[model samples]
Target: MAVVAIDKKDLLAFVGKALDDGELARLVTDLGMPVEKITESEVQVDITPNRPDMFSAEGLGRAISSLAGIKTGLRNYSATDSGVSVSVERSVKKVRPYIAAAIARNVKMDDALVKSLVALQEKLHDTLGRRRRKVAIGFTDFNKLKPPFTYKAVKPDESPFIPLGQSEPWTPARILKELKQGQDYGYILEGHGQYPLICDSEGNVIALPPIITAEMVKITPSTRDVFIDVTGTSQHAVHECLKIICCALADRGAQIQSVNINYGKKTLTTPDLSPLKTMLPIRTVNKILGMDFTTEQIKEYLERMGHGVEIKEKGKLSVVSPTYRNDIFQEIDLAEDVAIAFGYNNFEPILPQFSSIGKRSPSDVRAGLIRDLMIGFGFTEVLAPYITNRATNFEKPMLGEHPAIHIKNPLTENFTMFRSWCIPSLLEILAASKDQKMPQKIFEVGHAAILVDGKPVEQEKLAAAICDPKTSFNEMRSIVEGVAYELGLKLEFAGLDSHPTFIPGRAVEIIMDGKPIGVFGEIHPQVLNNFGIEQPVTAFELKLA
Candidate 1:
C-alpha cells in the first residue's frame, strides 16, 4: 500500500468540483483507496498496491469521476503517432531486453506538475518497476532530443556521460562507485560484462535504464514535450508501465503518441491503449456480492466502475477492462469491482443460524506448552516475521544451497523469501539488541514454512538463544537436557562436525529414541562478526512434539 497526500485545492480541481472532506473520503474509500487523514489543506490516502493508477491525483480523480456517474464506461484515449523511432540493438538483449516508448506531447508543466510526474515515476518504480529490476523508466525533454534513438550496450569503462544531478562526466563503472545512485542501484548492472544505455541520434545519452539519467535530457519545469521509455526483463511489464504513465499524462492535457519499437526481428509500436476484454458470469457476481441485480443494473454498475459491459444471452457479461487498471486479471477481480461499485456499507449482514464454540488446533496446544516451559526457564519469547532475505537466512547462517519459498514479485529485498528454520530469526533478534543489555535470553515457538516436494509445509518449531560473554555450548546442552528430562524422555548427544555454521567439534547433535532430533553449540566467531555481535552466544532448536 502507498500513502498519498494531495493538496485540497488541486484534488478539487482535478475532481472538477468542491467536495467536503467526509464526502471525498467516503467516495474514494468505495474505490478501495481509504482516507488515512484529511485536513483543511491536505488529504492523505492509503492506496492499495493493485491500483497503481490511483497513486497520482490525476488518476484518482479520473476514477472518482467515472465511478460517481460524472463519466461512465471506458474512457478512451487514442495515441497519435509521434514518428519517433527507438531502435533496439541486439547488444543489450542479454541484459535488459524489452523496451517500450511513448511521447507525451503538448505537456503543460508547472512546479506541481513536475513534482507529480516525479512522484508517479518513483511510486511506479517501487511497485510495478520491482525496484527497477523487472522494469525501469526514463523520461527526458522530447523536443531536446533528435529522432531515431538507439538502445544498446557498451563497455562500462568506455562509455562516459553526465549523470543526472551531476556536472562531471564519469564512466558507467565510476558512477557506480562515486555517485550515490550508483552505489545504491549499481547491483542491477555490476556483474554484467556490458551495461545498458539509451542514446539519441546525435550520440547524446538520454538516460541509463535502471540507473541515473543524463543531466542534459532530464525533465524540468520548463519542459513541455516529454519522451518516456520503459525497459524491463518482461515485455508485458514494460507495456503496462508505458500505459500507466501515458494515461496520467493524458489527464494533464498532454497528447499521447506512439513510438516505434524496432526489435530487429519484429517491429511494434508502444503505448497500446486498448482495453482488455473478458467474460464475467452474472451468477458468479451475484453469488459473491450476496445480492441479486438485474443485468441492466449490473451493466450500469460496471460502467460506473469504468468497465465496458455487453450483456450476453446466458447470464454472462463481456467486460472491457480499462488499460490503466491492471488488477482485473480474472472473473473474481471483476466481482470485487462490482462489490465496490455496489457499495459495501449498504450490504445487509445475515445472522448465523448455527452457533458453536471455537478452540485452538492441536499444534497450537503443543506450542503453548513449549512456550510456557521456556518462559518458566526465564527465557523471553519474541515474535518475528515469516519472510526474510537471503543474507540473514542463508549467508549469515552459513547454510549455502538451501532453498526457501521465494516471492515472485517482491516489494523489497528485506523480506523476499520464506524462512525454513527459526534459529536464524532468533540470532537476528540478538544482533539487533547488542546495545540494550547482556545475557539476553530469547526463544520462539513459531511456524516455519519448509519446502516439501516443491510445496510449502508449515510446521511449529521451538528455538532459543542465550547471549552473554560467558556463553558456551555446555549451557545450551544443559537447557536441552533439562527440557527432555521434564518431558520424561531419554536423549543422547553426538559430536557434530563438518557444518560451517558452528565450531568444528564444539557442536553436538541431540538424539532421542535412536533418532537425531536437534543440535546446539557455541556460536562461531565468524558468524557473530557477520551479524555485528561482539558477545558470545549459544542456541538450540527442535520441532515441537
Candidate 2:
C-alpha cells in the first residue's frame, strides 16, 4: 500500500463539491481506502496497489465525485492527432522493448498541479514500475523538442548527455558509476550489451530510459505543453501507464493529443482513451454478494463506480470500465464494486447450516493430556514454526540430511523446508535464550514431516530438552519413564552406541511392544558449540501416534 497526501483545497475544488473533513474521510473509507489522518492542510490516505489510477489528487476527486452522486458514470476523453511521430529503431527491440508516448497541450500548471504530478510519478514508479525495473516514466517540455523522435539502443560510450541537476555531460557508463539514482537502479541493465535511449529530431537526448532525463528540457509552471514517455518490458503495462498519465492531465484542463509510434513495419497511436467492455451475469452478482439486486439497481451501482452499464438481456449487463482502470479482469470485480456502492455494513449476517455437531477427535484429546502432563512436570511448552531452514534442522544439530519437503519457489533462504524433527527447534530456542537465568527446560509437541515414496508424510511427536550444568541422560530417562507411567504403557530401554547427535554409550532407545519409538541422551559437546550454547543439554523424543 502507498500513502498519498492531497491538498484539502485542491481535492474539494476538483470534486466540485463542499465537504468537511469528517464527511470526506467517511466517503473514502466507505470506498475501501482508509484515511490515515486529516490535518488543516491536507488529507493522507492509504492507496492499494490495485488502484493505481487513484494515486493522485485529480484521480481521487474523479472517483469521489461519482460515488457522491455529484458526477456519475464513466467520463470519456477524446485524443486528437498531434502529427508528432516517434521512430522505433531495431537496436532497442532487445533492451527496453516497448514505449508509449503522448502530448498534453494547454496544461494549467500551478503549484498544486505540479506537486500532484510529481507525487503521481514517484508513486507509480515505486509500485507498478517495480522500482523502475518493469517501467519508467519521463516528462519534458514539449515546446523545446522537435518532432520525429527516435528511440533506440546504443553503446554506453556513445550515449552522452547532461543528466538532470548537472551542468557537464556524462557518458552512460559514467552515470552508472557516479550518479545516486544510477547506482540504485543500474542493476536493471547489468548484463545488457547496450542501453536504451530516447532523443529528439536534433539528436538532443530527452532521457536515458530507466535512468535520468536530460537537463536541457524540463517542465515548470510556465510550461503549457508537456511530453510524456513511458518505456518498459511489458506492452500492457506501458500502455496502461500512458493512459493513466494522460487521464490525470486531462482532468486538470489539459488537451490530450496522440503521438504516432513507428515500428518500421506498422504504426500505432498511443494514449488510447477507449473503455474496455465485459459482460456481468446477474446470477454471479447475486451469488457472490449473497443478495438479489434488480437490473436498475445494478446499473445504478456500476454507474456510481464510474462504469458504463447497459442491460443487454434479462439477467446480464454489458459493463465497460475506463482504460485507466487496470484492475478489472472478470465479473467478480464488478460484484465487488456493487458491494462497495451498497455499503459493506448494510449486509446482514446469517448462520450457515451444517449436517452434524462437531466434537474433538481422539488425537486432539491425547494432545491435551500430553500438554497437561508436560506442564505438571514444570516444563514450559513452546510452539515452533513448521517452516525452518536446513542449517538449523540438520547441519547445526549434527544430523546429516534426510528426505524433507522443500519449497520449490522459496522467497528467502531462511525458510526453505519443513522441519523433520522437533529437537532442532527446541535447541534453537535455547540458543537464543542464553541471556536468561540457568536451568531452562522447554518442550514442543507438534507434527514432523518426512518423505515416503516422494510424498510428504506427517507424524505426531513430542520432544523435551533441559539445559543445565547438572543435566544428564539418567535425568531425561527418569522423566521419560514418568511420562510412560502416566499414559499406562510399559516401556523398555536399550543402550544406543555411536549416535551422531548424542554421546557414545550414554544414549538409550525407548521401546514399546518390542518396537523402537524414540531415543533419550545427553547432547554432544560439539553440537553445543555449533549452536553457540555453553551449557549441557539432555533431551528425549517420543512418537505419540
Candidate 3:
C-alpha cells in the first residue's frame, strides 16, 4: 500500500465541487482508498498497490467524484496527433528496450500542480515501477525540448548532462558515482557497457533514465505544456503507466496529444486511451455478493463505480472499464466493483452454517515427526527455496539434465526450476557454509517434483547430510536405519554402483516392499569439487510417503 497526501483544495477542485470534511472521508473510503487523516490543508489516504491511479490527487478526486454520483461511468480520453515522434534505436534493445511517450498541451502548471506531479512520479517509481527496475517516468517542459526525439543507448562516457537539481554537467559514469538516485539505482545498469538515454534532435540529453532526467527541461510553475516519457523493460507496464499519467493530465484540462514511436522497422502511437471491453456476467455478481440484484440494478451500480455497461445477452453485460483502471481483469473484478458501489457496510453479517475444525492432515503430521527426529539427531534443519537454478540442481550434482518443472520467464538465473530432489539443496547449504566450523550436519524435509510422462509429479522428500573430515557412507546408513526403526518398518540395504552423484563403491540403496525407495552414499569427489566443498560429505535422500 502507498500512502499519499493530497492537497485538500486541489482534491476538491478536481472533484468538481466542495465536499465537507466528513463527506470527504466517507466518500474516499467508499471509493476504497481509506482516509488516513483529514486536516485543514491536506488529506492523507492509503492507496492499495493495485490502484496506482489513485496515487495522485487528480486520479483520487476522479474516483471520489464517481462514487459520489457527481461524475461516473467511463471517461473518454482522446489524443490528437502531435506530429512529433521518437526513434527507438536498436542499440538499446539489450538494455531498456521499450519506450512510451506523449505530449500534454495547454497544461496549466502551478506550485501545487508541480509538487503533485513530482510526488506522483516518485510514487509510481517506487511502487508500480518496481523501484525503476521495470518502469521509469520522466516529465519535461515541452517547449524546451527540440523534437523529434531519439530514445537510444550510448557509451556511459559519450554523453554528459546536468541531472535534475544539479548545476554542472556530468557524464553518466560520473552521475552514477555522485548522485544519490544513481547510487540507489545504478546497479540496474551495473554490468552493461552502455546506458539508456533519451535525447532531442540537437543532441541535448533529456534523461538518463531509471535514474534522473536532465535539468534543462525541468518543469516549473510557469511551464505550460508538458512532455511525458515512460521507459521500461516491460512493454505492458510502460504503456499502462503512460496511459495513467496522460489521463491524470487530461483531468487537469490538458489536451493530450499522441506521439509516434518509431522502431527501426515500424511505428506506433502511444497513450492508447481506449477503454478495455470485457463481459460481466450478472449471475457472477449475484453469486459473489450473495445479494439478489436485478440486471438494471447491477448496471446502475457498475456505472456508479465508473464503468460503461451495456446489456449483452440474457445474463451478461458488456462492460467498458476506463483505461486508467489497471485493476479490472475479469468478471470477478467487475463483481468486486459492483459490491463496492452497493456499499460493503450494507451487507448483513451472518454466522457460518457449517461446523468443522481445521487441523493438519496426516501427511503434515508425519513430516513434522520426521523433522523432530532429525533435530533430535543433532542435525540443524535448513529450508531452501524450491526454485533453484539448473547449474546447482543438476550440473553441480553431476546428475545432468534430469526432467523437472521449469519457469517460463524466470526473473533471474539463480531461480529457474523446481528441485527434482533434496540432496542438491542440502549440498547448496553446505556449499554456502563452507567457512563455518568443520562439523556441519543438516536435514531438510520438503517437496520435490519430477516430470513423469511429461507431467509433473510431486512428493514429500527427506534428505540429510553430514559434512566433516571424518564422515563416511556408514554414518549416513546408520541414521537411515535408526529412522526406519523409529517408524517400525523393516528395510533392506543393497550395494549400489556407478551412481553419477555418489562414489561407485560406497553407495547403498534402501529397499522397502521389494522396491528401492532411497539411497545413502559417500558423495563423489567430482561432485564435491563442483560445489567447492573440501571436507568429505555423506548424504541420503528418501520419499516420506
Candidate 4:
C-alpha cells in the first residue's frame, strides 16, 4: 500500500462541486480511498496496488462520478491515424517479438502532466510488467522524429544515439554506461549476446527495451503531440502495455492513432481494442446478497457502472462492459460491481437468511484431537511454511513418490516447491536444533500435498518426531497407535516397505479405514549422516480421517 497526497484544491476542481462532510466521506470510501483525515484545504488518501488507475486525480474523479451516477455513459478514446509510424525489422524477431504504438496529438504538456506520466510509467513497469523486462514503453516527441520509425536489434558497437539525459551520442554498449539505466535495469537482458534496440530507418537509435531512450526525441512541455511505443517478447504482454499506455494518454485527452507493424507475413495494428458482453444473472444477485431488489433495480445499478443492461427473453440482464474493463470475465464480478454501485454500507448486516449451523468436519475433529493428545505427551507444536526448498522436499530419503506444486514465477529458489509431506520439514527443524540437549519431541498438525489420479489433493495429517540416542521405530509407532486409540480411530500396520529416504527393514506404513495414511520409521544411519544428525531419530505420521 502507498499513500499519495492528492491536492485538496485540485481534487475539488476535478470533483466538480463542493462536497459536504458526509458526502465527501462517502465519496472517499466509495472510491476505496483510506482517508486518514479531511481538513478544510487538503485530503490524504491511501491507495492500494491493484487500482493503479486511481493514482491520478482524473481516474479517481471519473470513478467517483461513475459510482454516484453523475456519469452514466462509457468514455472511449478516439484513435487519430495522422502522425508517427513504427516499423519492426526481422532481426529483432528472435530477441523481442511484438511492438505496438499510438500517437497522442495536442497534449497540453505541463509539469504536473509530465510528473504524472513518468510516475505512471515507472509504476506500471514495476507492477504489471515486472519492471519492463516483460514489457517496456517509450514516449518520443513526434515533432522531432522522421516518419516510419524502425524498431530493430543491431550490433552494440555499430549504432550510436543520444540517450535521454545525455549530452553526446554514444554506442549501444556505451549508452548503457552513460545513461545509468542499462546496468541497473538492462541486466535483465545483459546475458544475451545481442541487445534489443529500436531505431529509425536512417539508423537513428530510439530506445533499448527495459532501458532508457534517446534524448533527441524526449517529450517536453513545448511538445504538443508525442509518439508512444511499447515493445515486449510476448504478444499478449505487448497488447496489455498498449492498453495501459492508451488509457493513461486518454486521461490527458490525447487522440490515439493505431499504428500498423509488419511481422514477416503478418500485419498487426496497435491498440486492437475490443468490446465484450458480460451477462448478469438476475437471480444470482438476489441470492448472493439476499437483496430484495427487482430486475429494474438491478438494471439501474448496472447502468450506473457505465454499462447498458438489456433484459433478454430468459429474464437475465445482458450488461455490455467497456473494453477497458478486461477484469470482468465472470458473473460474480458483475454482481460485485452491482454491490459497489448499490452502496456497501446500505446493505444491512444481518444473520443468515437460511438457518444452518456451522460445524467442523470429521477430519478436522480428529486432527484437533491428535494435536491435543500430542501436546499432552510432552511434545511442542511447530508450524513451518507450506513452501520449501527442493533439496529438503524431494531429495530426502523418507520422502514419498508425490509430485510437488511448483511456483511459476518464484522470487527465490527456497520457495520453489509446495511441501508434499511434513516429515522432511520436521527433519530440517531437528537439524537446526542439534546444539540443544537430548529428548527433543516435536509435533506438527498441518496439510500435506499428494497426487491422486494425476491431480494434486491436499490432506490433513499429524506428524510427531522424537530425537534421542535411544529413540527407536517401535517407540514412535506405539505413540501413534496410542493417539489413534484416544481419537477412536482404528489403525492397521502393513508390511515393511522400502523407501529411498528410509532404512529398508525399519519402515512400515500406517493404514486407517483401508486407506494408507502415514509411515513410521527409524532414521537410517546413512540418511542421518546426510542430514548431519549424529543421534538416533524416530518419526511417525497419521492422516486424520
Question: Candidates' TM-scores?
Answer: 0.90, 0.71, 0.77, 0.74
Q: Any residue pairs clashing in model 1, and if so which? A: none
Could you give me the TM-score of model 3 versus the true structure?
A: 0.77
What tens digits encode model 1's per-residue C-alpha lDDT throughout 395-470? 9988885667997766666888888888889889988999977789999988787787888887677789999998
Query: Compared with the true structure, what per-residue lDDT tens digits does model 3 show for residues 1-545?
Result: 78998899999988888999999999888877778999999999999878889989889988888888898888889899999999999999999999999999998897777878888988888777877887899999999999999999999898989999999999999988879989999998889999999999999999998899999999887888999999998888899899989988898889999999999889889989999899888888898888889999999888988889899898889999999998888888998988889998999987777899999999989888888998989999999898898998889988879778998634445777998889989998898999999799999989889899999999888899999999997788889999998877689988986688999999988889888878899999999999989899999998887
| Cand. 4 TM to true fold | 0.74
| Residue 352 lDDT in candidate 3 | 75
Residue 500 error, candidate 2, Å: 21
CA lDDT, every model vs. true structure: 0.85, 0.89, 0.90, 0.74
Tens digits of per-residue lDDT for model 2 on 1-545? Answer: 89999888888887889999899998899889989999998989998878888899888988888898888898987799999999999998888998999999999888988999989998888777877777899999999898789999989888699999999999988888789989998998888989999999899899998998988888877899999999988777788888999999999989999999999999889988999899889889999998999989989988999999999999999998988888898889999999998889999998776678899999999999999999999899999888999898899988989889997533345677998888888888999999888799999889888899999989899999999999998899889999999999789999986667898888989899999888889998999899988999999988897
Model 1 ranges with Cα > 4 A deviation: 81-83, 90-95, 130-134, 165-168, 220-222, 233-236, 262-268, 293-297, 353-357, 487-492, 510-517
Tens digit of per-residue lDDT, candidate 4, span 149-188: 7777777786777778888887777766556787677666
